[model samples]
Target: MPSEQVLLKPRLAPMIWLTETSAPVCVEISDGLRRTLFRRMSSLISGSLVGLIIIAILLYRNPIPAFFAWAAVDTILVLFRFAVIGRLMRILRDPSLRRPRDTLVVDAFIAGSVLWCAQIGVGAFLCMSLGDPVLAVFGTMLSTGIVGAMCARNPGSPRMVKLQMVLIIVPYAAGAAMGPEPWLWPIVLIAPLYLWGTISINRELHIDYLKMLMAQQESSHLALHCSLTGLPNRSSFKARLKAAERNASVLFLDLDGFKAVNDQHGHPAGDALLTAVGERIRGCVPDPADVARLGGDEFAILVHADDERTIPAIATRLIAEVARPYALPTGLVVRVGLSIGIATRRDADNDPMLLLPEADQALYEAKRAGKGTYRWFQPANDADLSSQVRELRDMLPKAQTVREHGFEAGLSVTRA
Candidate 1:
């Protein structure tokens, strides 16, 4: 028989701890804190088991009702601690409850409900067995109130801190007021332990909030920056352009023969060319002069030139930079060229979009002259070639035979 290969799936780390009666531990929190929480919870459960065994042996030797009553109270709290600690860990571990908003509104409510129910139940059990209905009922009610308040103010306000403080005191008050003999000792010890747990949860909430704020800041920063070139994006560019009150010039620079680079050398080479062009443009622009990737194969530069003469100089630098040879990934060396159109603020147009059209027209003239050149828009230049005629001329060869069937020449075709 031929052997069949079976793919084994990687298992997720278990969310619950079986030793502490299935307590939940949040992995996203600090490793040291998580380790401490885990160690303490585990150790407490282990210690509780040993203590119960010792009590069992003592009870066998001398069957005292007071001792049994104390043991019963201790056992109840231990089980309660196991359940609450387990539930708290589970709630924190829950991916949904990691955010404070999620914890306050959802997890806290659930934890409070469970604690309240357990308190009421335990109180009723003690009342029925120990013949002390007053202390049992009062203590349970206090616990229920404290937990309810904790849940209500769980949103990390001053009120939440105050409620948490009250909760810490409740255990002590209940311990002190409870009838003397055996039950008193467990109550006193349990109070401080629960207080420590509350403080731990509080610190965790603050740390989570701080992390969330940092993440939000990082996302905002990335949105303002271009992912490819690490330059300010078009939106940020527009905002900066509007803010500059100084007389400035805008140059719309388009890479000449970029489409040919993509066709001959593949997109990876085209991308490398674009990144190199971006770097060259960045070098061309001085500080306080901004550049942006307007879109694919096109970039814009806003310059605060020392003099109007600097425009031609800057454009010449850009042309020289781009015309240099680029080493492609295929080990093919290629020359990349650029066509830039400069439009000054002094030029009659006040509208930014108007500058674009004039700049675009000048760019058209530069491309027509051949690659690796710059052109400034001139009012006296009367050459306005129709785009439709240029497009039709491109399509004519493919449809030459079809045109022989019925088409008549009505326009003069010129190659650009």
Candidate 2:
């Protein structure tokens, strides 16, 4: 079918000459480099054609016919080259084209034919033995060097590079071998050496590209994951929450006595405890749920659950699991409890910011009700606090800023 599709398909045998092993090349990287090389080569070819036209005018006694013919052919090729470059630029912007490789191959073959025609003209214009044979050797060397440089930039697939190099070089070599001069036959012998050198460069570049890809992958993984607990960090968690289903739920967990652990022991012990808690939370959650450490002693989980009962059940399990004792590196057994607040899409309007606040309010309620427990958000309970302040205002009409005063007084009363 399409050349892009063909390139993507698994190769029957992708032979690397040094290793004698088969491996699939990365299609995206290869195609991108090919487009870049095509642009460079096309510009170079157009410039060379203009130079050839100038030389033909100076060398030939009857140059008018040759000029017009060269002008016609060069104009067509230049227009076609621009069209291909435009298509490639569009592909770079939006990758929807079906057969980029096929387009490139067609252009390459046309370029090869042009080179063959130029070589034949040069051999006919001058004596075949004197000027033609020397031109043939020089042309072959220049073509080989250009192709090798282009191939170095795109060493993803050995087979594809080999094919493109063959298309460009074989025609020129054939022209040299079939020339009228018997001495020029030996020029074709250098073709194998040129191919071997190009292949060697391509193999080395391919190995380097593979190493770069692996390093990039490792860096990406480290960026998205927490260094301490190896869980998804806050940034990754929020991204997942944004893309999560509308029916998903979030559980916000804060350790009850984590600060005391840090005070009694040290920050290292606190970190160890947090790591253990993260592991327990991971074990308790199902595959569809993602656990993230949202800095310090706070953590979050995004659970895929459309059912009303699923949130509470998961939250309760998490609280129990997190409350379990953790054995530290120093052989010290420490206990900590979890205060969890759960908010579902039905309660939070499917907004993470709103969902988080709902969970936070519920978490405050859980801490007020006494830690080591979980709570679901209740809008009525929120309104009841304001109603209680209003009742205090009615009882004492002098209380103007009752909302702030009532909250402070409530905290004092709870402490007492």
Candidate 3:
């Protein structure tokens, strides 16, 4: 029931409970709601089987046509709900249908759950009104158990739980009040008080859970993003690149004259310059080509085929934007030049991993040509990319170590 604890599960929901909106990246159900549904399904099946046993015992003791009729209708609804739960569980696991069917699946789950509670309430009413002392006690115990389970199992929105609680208790209380026995009147008052108590307990648990979830998400955000520039970190860049399209391109950017700013204006001014430079790079590119700050003065961007801009045009725009003078918080106007290396995937069958080395090789060439310029990988042909990649790998060795933790260990570029 824990949502994939992985860092790359698309957009982090602002608030997952009590409210829902269109997902910006992909449709995702919260972990808590999934857990609650799973428990509900399990409890309902077990409770229904036990209830059938009680109904059978009552019929054997003294045959009642009215009791048998009620049981038949109740049993049919219980069986139908089992089917609904089964289908919903399967739907929740389907990745293809997530975007189109997520809202429908969750809504169906809620509707089925509410109806299950209403079924319990209807039975409670019938049993209490039957004028049989044994049956009345049996129904009261069952209703109380359902409410207790609801209290323990529910971690979804409080509003949905509140609606379910009312459905479960009100009908039973009304039936108890209408009973011929004077002793049954006490149950009517007690039922409302019981509901109030359960809701109070639920509220406290929910608040605590929300606080914990928020803290965990914030921690994950900090780990995957650069603190100075608020851009994705090197690890994040590697993750995104691994999943990039076959026709994607990689760009490696290094800041020229960055040390001059740090030497003259101090580290604070250098920090401000980095932040400003990051913003400018981000502004130069549109969707599908995100920018990442890959440690001091080095940044990378993944330009997928879906982006509107070509690799050369995007690189040119990045160089131009980053080279502009930046006014720091220290009131110093400092400038930095950008050197870019471009590597575009030539074929759909090519391995995406090769793009990284090629981009780095091109960046080296660009720096050699002179700072503040961009260069593309000039292979003899597509066949030469493999041999070049092997040479690059040998230059910086490590096989298994490099692949672990999503390619963060792969690169070893020594600045000349």
TM-score per prediction, in order, is 0.45, 0.60, 0.79
Worst 10 residues of 1 by lDDT: 1-10
After best superposition, candidate 3 residue 32: deviation in angstroms? 5.5
Instruction: Please give the CA lDDT of all the candidate structures.
Output: 0.58, 0.65, 0.74
> Which regions in candidate 1 have their CA more than 4 angstroms from the true location?
1-226, 347-349, 379-416
Clashes of 2: 0
lDDT, candidate 1, 63-112, per-residue tens = 66755765686577567667655655664455444334322322232334
Report how far off residue 415 is in candidate 2 (Å): 38
lDDT against true structure, model 2: 0.65
| Candidate 3 backbone collisions, by pair | none
TM-score, candidate number 1: 0.45
User: Number of backbone collisions per candidate, in order?
Assistant: 2, 0, 0
Give the per-residue lDDT digits (tens) of candidate 3, residues 131-226.
678878877887877787677566546666777788878988887988887789899899999999888876766666555655776687799999
Candidate 1 C-alpha error for residue 240, in Å: 2.7
lDDT for each residue of candidate 2 in 1-416, tens digit (9 for 90 to 100) = 34443332332222222112134435444443333333355545654465455445433533455445644554565566556556545554445654545445334433443443354344223322233544444444445554656467555555556665665566655666667877666657876678777878887886776666656656876888889999998888888988776787778899999999989999899889988998999999988798999888999888888686877778888888888789999778999999988877764455665666787888888899899898888766868999998888797754656877898999999999
- Residue 216 CA displacement from its true place in model 1, Å: 4.8
| Ranking of all predicted structures according to TM-score, beginning with the best and ending with the worst | 3, 2, 1
